[model samples]
Target: MTGCLDDLDITMVEEGFTTKDLLETLLKEASQRGSREAFFVADLGDVVKKHLRLLKALPRVKPFYALKCNRSKEVVHLLAGLGVGFGCAKKPELALVKSAGVPVDRIICTGPCKQMSHIRYAASQGVQLMTFDNEVELGKVAKSHPSARMILSLATDESRSSGCPSVRFGATLKSCRQLLETAKDMNVEVVGVSFHIGSGCTDPQMFTQSIADARLVFEMGAELGYKMHLLDIGGGFPGAEEAKGRFEEATNVVNSALDLYFPEGCGVEIIAELGRYYVDSAFTFMINIVAKKEVPLDQPGSDDDDPGGKKSFVYHLNDGVYGSFSSVIFNNTCPVPILHKKLSPDSPLYSSSLWGPTGDGLDRIAEGMDLPELHVGDWLIFETMGAYTGPASSSLSGAQPSRIHYAMSRVAWQAVQLLQGKLLPPEEEDQECTCAPLSCGWEITDTLCVTPVFAPASIM
Candidate 1:
């Protein structure tokens, strides 16, 4: 509703249509062309659902979607239109969000270690909010972006219990005084406190402890003559529906903690950096099996038996760890494969491993899979691939990332529009239609705001 929706090339689908239907259509087209090209189908509707969940569950805390998770312009635009703030770690991400017509106030320049040029660029663009964790970072910010409103990045002491000090980021509690003093001496305005309890944290007590620590820091900032009005409890909520219970539990913990630590009418603005929670389950990655091999391991002292029966299969897919499945290497994500073709109810399962087309030993995507025999050109759909896969994908060794197709059901489109206060009077359902180029202007064909309208039917 805030940004222009006419520019987005979204495949408007019927209410009953799902991403699987769109993926099936594309897979059929690919098979017909004798092409084993891999691609992704992103449900923009899912993103809207996730955003609404955040607003409904944690009404007090605003969510700033980390662009590091997925910088897909379609997502950025949709979120912008929905009035979600952005957390950008670099200048390019800032530019990406800004290109979607996001205001500077809605964009916070994040990360402790930032380039001078990036700071200068953000300052030049009238971006005011930023975060820092050290005296050196404070000095840099004071020199580069004097008018910058800074949030101190506080590090949690979880490692004190876990006995792993090396896994932590941000400034320690003992050093908070020195950092605040240095910021004051330099005339740098330290506006608030922020902390990240790492990604994928499962314990709600960790968030509780972190929130308590932030309360201490906020008190410290106030004593040092800082306003300390903002508190950013960084994100680690699960992404997929299977983990919905955990997400709800975590939000409940966060809300209770906020009430106890920085209650309502406390004059402190609250926000969270939500990365995986927003996009991970929205995009489904589909890759074709390019090659397969029977792998055998030696059986010692098996004089009467053949080792062939114990052999496992290694199937190479079009995209792998280096490309669309980079989360395998970075986040240790285990991608579950969904066969495009159905097998018999009693179909025997075989031990299988999956690798990439590049043939690099390090390019393995997944292993310990019990899948039926798959051949060349067969497809495997990997759901929840939207988190860190797309933006971090590499073309290393000619491993091209899958082309992305964006879509949303007509009902979902209407819901988001209505939620954003941009939906017009009631209208008929959108007919079966594909995507149009973003450069083309769209107008209303019926009573709705969108006109009745890809590679695989849509592009964003």
Candidate 2:
């Protein structure tokens, strides 16, 4: 992969290879590849842009990419090369990060409760940074890995949390002093405090409150004769454009709170666990229409007469709720559809319902959607799917999973090349060169071409 990008000269974006252009090219390439099912088209360049955006928004906080979001090695390798840290909740996730050559200090083992084996493995690997929220977990860490550096996890105010984890994980504010004393008694080193406002948090004030609560805990740890140097602001950053405004607002509020509570020269190191922020918009899922059924309009006296008396179009796709659409059920994400080809302004629309290629009636994707008339063999795409989609997909009915096709825009590719030139070592440079042959590939300045590579499916 490095060799493929190294051949091109690092250049500017004036050549105009936008995301729309890349998607158009990828659609054509998919057809030529003889694919008749669902596939993924991932833009590595978009991940790069998201990292830069995070830096601009929160210069004081460092992000540790959540490994449970999308565990594609390509995504991890790209982020590792760009010097991003990682957050792992399980042993496999920690191993994957290590396989990408990320050092132990750059990876933090973060979960309220963890297995003893996981603790032993992390300790053996020199991953000392971990989180705990209960006495049982504290005892486990003390017995198994007594040298571990622990961060106490606290519950957030539920009214401010959008997707709350309080019931399952974090400790309450009233319980903080007792837990700190217990840790002191167990001889476990309590060096920090952590809390998650929630996933998809809408209240920026939640951040302000969480930080203030963390400050109180920090003072408590100090009173217990412990040095509190780290503050882990857990994950909740939104990644899509519709939520970008809210994300920015939250960033501003968080920035103000950090300045007030944990400003620089305060000797406190702040880090965040961000999952969807870096990869959500970088992925687009393309599903092929496998079958279609058109139901006749109900008559006035019909048994199934809808209020609008509209006909229903049922379309079956290769992917479903058990697969890439698992986020629909797990994260409550509703993916918007886009046609592969443009329709005229005057094209007629009809009531449509999309379903997965499964025997289960519950595998519906969309219902009562007003879409232009569609047919078998046509392709439908859903964007902003890079976050919780891939890692949640399963092979529940013996259905083979879909493959991923990775490509980058010319501007993004150039940015990667520039980074590689400066960061990568000489011997490790371009040890392998691989490319996918496609007719509609990206041509940059007529001197370089960008092709998509097929990545094997990984079952969660």
Candidate 3:
């Protein structure tokens, strides 16, 4: 009975009613009017910008966003606008980014299982830079495109991801040296050394340690008479405030480590591949709760700790593992729900479980999660759903995928209504504007006009 809902008040607000009312309002008046389902594929443009700002703040490291995170054309276009390149993990990703008008030179094609066709295409398109691990891969490149430019990807021990190279991509330090020797013998230009320290990396010192390992590789490359010019520090930067520590401090430590190990005048192009950090916080998924239940709690040491005893109610919402399986199973992330509409600070809190639309027991989104007791048809707004929640992720569930929507402009709703009246029917305009000038204080009078709210500097 006591958890996140411990402080919640059970009384419904007279003006607000319950979450059901708000969802019913939106469904009847808003979603029904639109063609797509109520669920949305949240946009990541703002989040991409935030990640770019963080990258730009770093002294000399350039970021190439890992495109596999989410390959929606809209998301790719947004990242391109932010001056970030694509870290393509597959052939299609390279093609997708290139088709968006991003220059070939700006793309880095990398993957352990890259086919010869993809390699040839990348080489022909002037995307000369790539990564390779084993001698077989090096031989494959040499046989197919002898003059291909490549990086020797080294396997680092700090990675915390599921695929952390027990036997996958990236050569060992010894293997890196051997691969470099093979590349030199085959006339391949080994221009860089790359390492991935893993995703959701909370330890900043891991980066410093990885840098030290990279420098040892650099020294090896140097001894082999091959002076590499690029050092790619692979991505793992956390997006959430809790997982991610102070930005400046982390970057400072990385820079300091680089300075201590990298010799001056080496002139290496420092690059990083960031996926989650860029698009993680840019969007939210608003789901409608379908059911609710509350049970009484029993004292464990007392005589009343029996099954089917009094317990707390649980709330079920649409979209579960099948829709956002990556965030749950792959990333092990818990989506925090925020009430869009205001609730009393003292609203009754309740222990709750969350289920997706399907009845499968494994379809649970959260269990024993705490929130204000959600009524059936109330909305659960999941924040930081931008990174991997999109149509591409919903392939297995095969349900109607979340409809993607966008709103970058800041024009007030009234102002947008005013502007569209001159061009088209009021009912036909679907674009929503977010603009609200601080100077005006949102006074809506006959003569009230507001200015645009474009960012003078890009959003951080």
Candidate 4:
């Protein structure tokens, strides 16, 4: 945590310091400097809170922060320091967590279809906790990383949860036995069962069936003489303020299922690959409007949600689906931007469509946003933009990814340091999934120490 935190320029702040407050301060500085680049203000304290809350909710399960989500180095380091394991999908990801001082035993190679080189790399590093859903993958691991402790991935019925038709990944329940048998035949060690209910899963009951399916797989592994000691109920937990209720409901559902199937002291180590649940609400993105266009309602080939709607406004932002907003294309995310400053409550609203700076036609950010008519120099604020936004980028045209200014309260930094290697007990008797709220007070004489985000030339 020292080296990672040393290289990272995190701002040390007092209690009650928020992301918006930092953004407001930066906005004025940007005005004088004429800097229009998109950026993020990430509240590291919120991330710390979520990790503590997770331990309080599911005491039996270990959390492996998935690298594919966000993959911000600072976030990874913070979580690593707090004892969250890493779920690496590729070679570079493995290097990342390893560089952060994550032990090979604490990391899981979660990618199913791994390349031969990647497998060798993982093996060379002694990262033996790999996942495979099919015999081919198992065979590859047998030949390459024979010492691997593989987790058999069981497919969940994700149609109801993912909203889209099943985008399949894991092995089906019927296929589980055959896969386990094959692992035995190939002399590959199958030590656990894993499943992802799917990203953005709405139904918590979906996890119930997956847990049941995993239990059956565990039995099958036992039948095959495989020592199954791990059960991974993979990620789908909610993170937004609105999704707090759903997250709590999911906590109850998952905890009950684990209790019923993999009870306490069951000799099974449970782990979860949580990505978005830890970072979504902690980050706020600010994109500058670079260009604007006004098209008459009668114009042909113009995009409009309301037919016969008045003039349509199109605004081009500095970052788009090609870069930081890749979630727009991949996750079907429609980002509704919040104006940096609400200048007028009575301002006329118009049919506005937001597009990223990329010249491609598919680089649209949001369509049919009922926004007050804004100008080229105005700024747009977007929250819940942390997960899947940064990691999915294609980096079209070799443009630099936006910067993130990390901040945490002194209280939070100390709190996290104290709880680094231990899980704190639930303070509230009735609240099952919540951590004891931080009792913090601001010191009037405290000074804010920020990591340098702006270059000296830019500031001047």
Please give the CA lDDT of all the candidate structures.
0.78, 0.74, 0.62, 0.79
From the highest TM-score down, the ranking of the candidates is: 4, 1, 2, 3
Q: Show pairs that collide, candidate 2.
A: none
Per-residue lDDT of model 2, residues 1-460, tens digit only:
3223333222222334554565566677767997686777677766766765676678788777988889877788778866678988999999888877788888888887799999999999999988898999999999999999998998887564545457578888889999999999999999899887666567778888889999999999889899999998877877766686988988999899999999889999998888888888888888889988876655221225333346557788888888888887777766778898788977767767788888577677777677777999998888878877752446563466677777655545544554455422123233353432222332111123222221111101
- Name the lDDT value of residue 335 in candidate 4: 84
- By TM-score, the better pick of 1 and 2 is 1
Cα misplacement distance, residue 184 of candidate 1 (Å): 0.4
Give the candidates in order of lDDT, highest first: 4, 1, 2, 3
Off by over 4 Å in 2: 1-15, 160-162, 295-310, 391-393, 413-460
lDDT of 1 by residue, 32-136 (tens): 898878888999878877876677678898888999889898999888888889999999999988888888888899987899999999999999899988777
**Model 2 weakest lDDT span, ten residues long:** 451-460
TM-score of candidate 2 against the unseen true structure: 0.83
User: Per-prediction count of colliding residue pairs?
Assistant: 0, 0, 21, 0
How do the residues 28-130 of candidate 4 rate in per-residue lDDT, one tens digit apiece?
A: 8888898998898888877877776677677788898989887888898998888888899999999989889988878999887899999999999999999
Error of 4 at 137 (Å): 0.5
Specify the poorest-scoring 10-residue window by lDDT in model 3: 1-10
**RMSD of model 4, in Å?**
6.7
**Local accuracy of candidate 3 as per-residue lDDT tens digits, 156-243:** 6655544344236677776677777888888888888888766645567877877887888888888988878888887777665554
- Residue pairs with colliding backbones in model 1 are none
